[model samples]
Target chain A: MTDFWLAAALCLLLTMALGLVRVMRGPSGGDRILGVQLLGTAGIAVLLLLGAAFDMPALADVALIFALLAAVSVAALTRRRLTREDS
Target chain B: MEMTLQLWSMLCVGAGLFFFAVGTLGLLRLPDLFSRLHALTKADNLGLGLVILGLLPWAGDGFQVLKLTLIWLLVLLGGATGAHLIAKRALRADGEEMLE
Candidate 1:
């Protein structure tokens, strides 16, 4: 079971690396940020799987923090863009 | 019963992994920002939710279950709002660029 969880986490990490390709090739800011969003999400899933695999519930808390920060980062950037445009 | 639960967890987690893969593929191949955003948010949240569902049985107690549920809910809310805001920003920037 632990092996299975770890393998799943590896798969997610692969996908995240592929997502980074999008970030690299992005022709627009929106696309780039979207790729970053994908990274954050996959990261959370990987963290959760690792938590489960290692029998450590603490990683869930880390995932929760990742979720919150992921949300805030994008929103903050968007807000800053808006404010900069206004001024 | 233990075997059954383990099998169930594997199944759910496997499905979640598939969704995450599909979401990433969409993000890479989708034509434009709006469509890519569409793929990102829906697939990302659904995949994450499925992952959490799979982990539920492994949760040590009621408290762990609650914590997992809360995390999923937070991700869902945050993803939706972030997607919306990103879309709005993209639209505004597009309009501004055209004006220029």
Candidate 2:
């Protein structure tokens, strides 16, 4: 709940928003994937910041789960894309 | 002691934010998929690490710290693996012409 954490979180949110531009304007699918990854990473950081600021330790766990799933999603997408290419 | 912790936390968090900003810039400005992947992995990993470090002092316990570290490690591992796969796929679909 401190000013410092709040400000940092806001900055991270800004980066996530900027990343969306890349997602929307991508020259390729990989680039869009990268944008989503950026957003996911930023979102994790924001969750951690909020967890700290609000003294809710449980949010950290949510962030952990989010991070794990985000990575898996990327891997799954890449695999699917690769397999699609074979056919 | 409290003031020092606050200052240190601010410095760490600010640095993390800066790295994220740089990574986003790289994503925006980088000319190709490989280079963009390079930017995303390096900057975002370091950025997330620094942010976690900044928040370490306030962590509820040793368990939380461990959890945070695990999350970071997994993200990096996954990101790297995914990047490799994407590169392989991109190269295959586009042929060698995509890189140039």
Candidate 3:
């Protein structure tokens, strides 16, 4: 089980790297936003994995909070994009 | 017993990671915003779901599993909704029809 989670974590890290590349090289604003969104999702997964591996229940709450924040941020950004277009 | 649990956990984690990798690749390789969104949503949902599954065996009990499950649900809901909103706003802003 420990080995399994470790491997999974490693894979998730690799995924993060890929998303990071997109963030760095994204041609447009929307691409960057998508990259960041991907990162947020990956981060939440990592946190949950840590919580379970370390027996830290509080980490679950942290993941929850992060998810909420990510959601709100995306919404705000989307709204901004819409308004910018209108103007 | 513990050993078996650990192995299963590893498999779950590995699957999760694989999904993440695929998502990342899609994000980088896809041409358009809508296509990228497809990759992001699919990868994020499956990747996180796998991670949660891997951790389930080690969780203390039913309550802990329940908590984890709830978190998973929240991720799915939040991720999908957020992506949808972003895509919609982007489309409307550009005067482009939303992609299915």
DockQ of each: 0.60, 0.54, 0.53
- Residues B52-100 of candidate 3 have per-residue lDDT tens digits of 8878877788988898898888878888898888677777665543221
Residue-by-residue lDDT tens digits, candidate 1, A17-44: 9999998888877787888789888899
Runs of candidate 2 exceeding 4 Å displacement: A80-87, B94-100
Model 1: residues with Cα > 4 Å off, grouped in runs: A80-87, B94-100
Q: A1-87, model 3: which lDDT tens digit per residue? A: 445455556667777887889888776667777877887889888787777657687888898888888788777666642347677
Highest TM-score scorer: 1
CA-RMSD of model 2: 3.2
Candidate 2 residue pairs in backbone clash: A1-A53
The top-ranked prediction according to lDDT is 1
lDDT per residue for candidate 1 within B1-100, as digits (tens), equals: 9999899999999999999999999998889889999988899899998998999999999999999999999989999999988888888774453112
Which 10-residue window in model 2 chain B sums to the lowest lDDT? B91-100
Quote the lDDT for B19 in model 1.
94
Clash pairs of candidate 1? none
Q: Judged by DockQ, which candidate is best? A: 1
For model 2, report the TM-score of its A chain: 0.87
Write down the TM-score for model 2. Answer: 0.90
Quote the B-chain TM-score, candidate 1.
0.92
Docking category for candidate 3?
medium
